[model samples]
Target: MSLLVCAYVFVPETNTTVAINEQPKAPFNNLFGFESWRQTVWDSPILRKHNCTLLNSLSSQDIYAGDAVLLQLQNELEVIKEHIDQITDELNLHKESFAFRIDNAFEAIRIAQKVTNGIVYIG
Candidate 1:
């Protein structure tokens, strides 16, 4: 069997939150956050991808650490929680798979906040 390993690289904050959180300038696309593998997994045709694509976007930079970034992370957790609730209602029969992923993501966010002292950055 092939192994699928997940790796994350943490970087330090080099500038203040303003420098990092500014709503991307004209040259940029103004979008934030990284797409999780959850996206790809749910995209499978057999899975019957529903309208529960809420956790797909994050409103802050993934490679920077700051209060705004942490806030964004927290917000994402809340979003996931809400999505979980909605999805559970819609797909009562198959809530385990989705709920498990949401739970894992929430736990990951909590751990990152604790370990990094609210300064979690992805590289």
Candidate 2:
């Protein structure tokens, strides 16, 4: 079976007000433009730093789904999209497996641009 990693965007809470049984309404995995992979690169500190930078750039002081953070996120995603494009172009000789992942990553970032919540990744 193939491994699938999903990404989610949600509100960051200071306390555990939510019940354990409740499921968060975070954005769909595809919303963040994340791609499926076998490893755990998404949880890395470097990536988290990038995510933090994006969030810090948002207008709203709190993380939520409608505070006008979308624009900022979109702008941040552009940088990642450019890098992915470059890698995809370089791998033109083998556009079968990794290429598809690159495509998925692009799609995820595109969707993430419209999101308003802070990013919460689940793999």
Candidate 3:
């Protein structure tokens, strides 16, 4: 089985007077398949060092408010991309494929960062 890392921007309904029982709306522009790279991301030293909640959580549902988390994840991905070539073959990682996945995931996060008063959902 392959794991796909997808990010979506969810804008909550703004009903100040009374609570509305309606599903949140999100755009499908930000999405990418991570394939088998879930473990790689979960074990990333750069992400671990920064204590990325979204990336580190084992839960299927994770949410982050604002672009700060998005920017931090993007930076960590950049650091991993820089040193991806240094990873040993013993880990069975494809440098090119993994790099492509990182790029796609980066773009997804970048797109999600543009939404104001919206929460980012990762799963």
Candidate 4:
């Protein structure tokens, strides 16, 4: 039952907002959790392909049907996969850039603090 629930939500897109449950609280409740989740998704080509096919087929809309519809769904799925991959790459690049900038900024602050230590007190 737990495995079934996990499998169902392992690639949940925000198409609908059915209340999952009401848990009191948890340690991971922020961007870090989302980042890890995203990494899990972006790390696996097989998983991505699985999600792509599942998402395209699972919807009950006009996209689900005969050969022509299936082809169009496949095409649209390919486009969505490309976009997801591109976004993941861009997010990784930005994360790296932000870390670099923050590191540099901290280094600058440290140097400045050293230079002003005789005349200034931080605390």
User: What C-alpha lDDT values do all the predictions have?
Assistant: 0.38, 0.37, 0.50, 0.30
Question: Candidate 2: lDDT of 13?
Answer: 71
lDDT of 1 at 49: 41
lDDT of 3 by residue, 1-123 (tens): 444444444545642222122222343223333534445655455456555555655234443534676676676667666666654243456776666656666655655555454333444
Rank ordering of all candidates by lDDT, starting from the highest:
3, 1, 2, 4
Question: Looking at candidate 2, what is the lDDT of residue 57?
Answer: 27
Where in model 3 is the C-alpha error above 4 Å?
13-37, 44-54, 58-65, 88-90, 118-120
Shift in Å, residue 116, candidate 3? 2.2
Q: Where does candidate 2 have its weakest 10-residue lDDT segment?
A: 15-24
Task: Write the number of the candidate with greater lDDT, choosing between 1 and 3.
Answer: 3
Expressed as tens digits, the lDDT of each residue in 1-123 for candidate 2 is 333322234536762222122232333222322233222233334334456354332222323322354444445445445554443454332334444543443344444444544332212
Report model 4's TM-score to 2 decimal places. 0.22
Per-model TM against the reference: 0.40, 0.34, 0.57, 0.22
Q: What's the lDDT for candidate 2?
A: 0.37
lDDT for each residue of candidate 1 in 6-90, tens digit (9 for 90 to 100): 1122445753321123222233222222244333333222233433223232212233433565566556546545665554555
Task: Give the clashing pairs for model 3.
Answer: none
* Model 2 residue 2 CA deviation in Å: 3.6
